[model samples]
Target: MVWTLPEPMLAEPVNNPALPPGFAAEPKWDGYRALLARYADGRVVIRSRRGTDMTAAFPEITRAAASLPAGVEFAMDGELIVWEGGRVAFERLQGRLNRTAAGAAGMAAQWPAHYVAFDLLRRNGTDPDLTAQPYTARRTALEELFTDQALAPPWTLCPSTTDPTTAAEWLEWSAVGMEGLVLKNLRGTYRPATRAWRKYRVAHTADAIIGAVSRSLTDPATLLLGRYDPTGRLRYTGRSTVLPRPLATTLPARLSPAGEEHPWTGRTFSATWGAKAALTVVLVVPELVVEVRADVSRDSAGRWRHPVKPVRLRDDLAPADVPLFGDDTTTSLT
Candidate 1:
């Protein structure tokens, strides 16, 4: 029976690093989540989490998939990453996305992508659907296929370990662009779009200046944060998630309207990257510093890619105490 790829399975956030018994932990790669499939007719497809066809945008991955041995039809779940400066460079991988075929080919020569397969969806036309099978059985099949096919280069088998010590050790791989860990139950089945897996990403707290805010100053929703670069430009670092009721009440007291010289005076902020909706930003004096807990994930410009969790107002800290825009978290987020 021919197997078709399903929507990507999602993972729920987890805080503990301890790997539970009967669960296998894999280092969460800091890159785009993709599903790859090769058909009996020699057709190859690479798709994104949102069901976008990304085959043309990543010629290197497409070429690798097309090169699989005859009759090796399979579908696999994995990440698309690029290695640069001795580590995974997610910004480099972003260069290949949403490009013309020719443009992608050129970028591929400079920053080729690698597919890190972590889950096997199906093996071949004759094999029964693997999504219903337990993770252990599918994982074993995936390993055997890798060994038998002698996959190399663009193809990578993600490391999985059931040992708690090994899983904890993988967390340190954050230095090399690993986000953290995805712990999967051995007896679990692949349920697309379901939070059947647990994810633990590296998180840290840092200080940022409140340059603007969403909603009225008296009842703000989120704080737009910024940090000065070496050139003394207050670059937008990231924004906070919706404030807790108690925290929301405390901010208006400390915040004041921005002066004429505010860095973001004429600028408009988007609700999200590439989003069309503009945020209702109320520019504030860039003096109030706040502590925020953020994941290791960042954008090409060192801005936090996800909304940071506001810990508290760091009244003791000056705007200068925050890390420079180009100083911290040199990575990219999903």
Candidate 2:
């Protein structure tokens, strides 16, 4: 009797120490999570992580999936990133996912999102859900099936390497903002929704002396902040978060003016940070000594992205000690 296959399992984070040496690593692309499903009848479906049907939202991609090799059904996992003006416009892809008909159409014409297919969960006459099948076998089958298709939002297979140093270099020099690296064992089989894989993320922090404090926009409280690269010649590297509440109250008087520039924008606003968005306080002083973690790679405007989280105060650190870039002092908490 023939056994049926189940939907492919997704990878989740595991203990950092579980990552053994010699595993292949690839950049974790930042974009929408999608599963491409092609039925035996040639019908295609694109489902979001929430199980929402998105085939209509990405018509061009649907057409592309239909062009895959005949007599095979496939389920592939990947992201849809729209490249515009020499940079990946994640916001444009978000607009498409939100199902704003006008907005999606405009973005599609301006910067269509590309379907980056990476893994094949199902294919040919076989059900890829069999837990015993190895990952290399599935990958090989996927490459052979989709090698000839001309899909819209074109498809690119993400490459992997066993060299951590090379992988680190790729993460640093990635033209598009890369989340990090996914390390997978070559001999491992597909383990759905399990911690069979490991991810090495690139996190950063800068040590800067406390310079000033700013009043929080939503609350009566203030935020203790600091700045790096106080020369005024270099653009703002990024702003540090407030000190702990106990320290924040007494921070104002002890703060010394590090530079002339104010760290806060003096404007109260909220913005998205990584997977979540929150209200943030902006200041323009360099008085506080603190550290911030974030991806500082250049955006479309040539400015670094702001800090996602300010870990803590670094009272022992000095302003001059901060490296402008290429310093990886922040240890991985993962």
Q: Put down candidate 1 lDDT per residue, 1-334, tens digits, no spaces.
A: 5557899999999778789989999999888999999886778999999998888898888888787777778889999988887667777866466678888999999988999999998886455579999999989989988998899988999999998888888877766667889999999999999999999888877788899999888989999999999999999988899998889987899889988899898898889854669988999889998888888767557777779988899878888887888576422222
Clashes of 2: 17
Query: Per-prediction TM-score, please?
Result: 0.90, 0.69
What lDDT does candidate 2 reach at residue 44? Answer: 85
TM-score of 2: 0.69
Which 10 successive residues of model 2 have the least lDDT summed? 217-226
Estimate the lDDT of model 1: 0.85
Task: Write the residue-wise lDDT of candidate 2 on 226-304 in tens digits.
Answer: 3334344333333334445655555555544333355444433333323334444434344345665555343443333
lDDT of each: 0.85, 0.58
Alpha carbon lDDT of residue 292, candidate 1?
A: 86
Q: Candidate 1: list runs displaced more than 4 Å.
A: 92-97, 125-128, 329-334
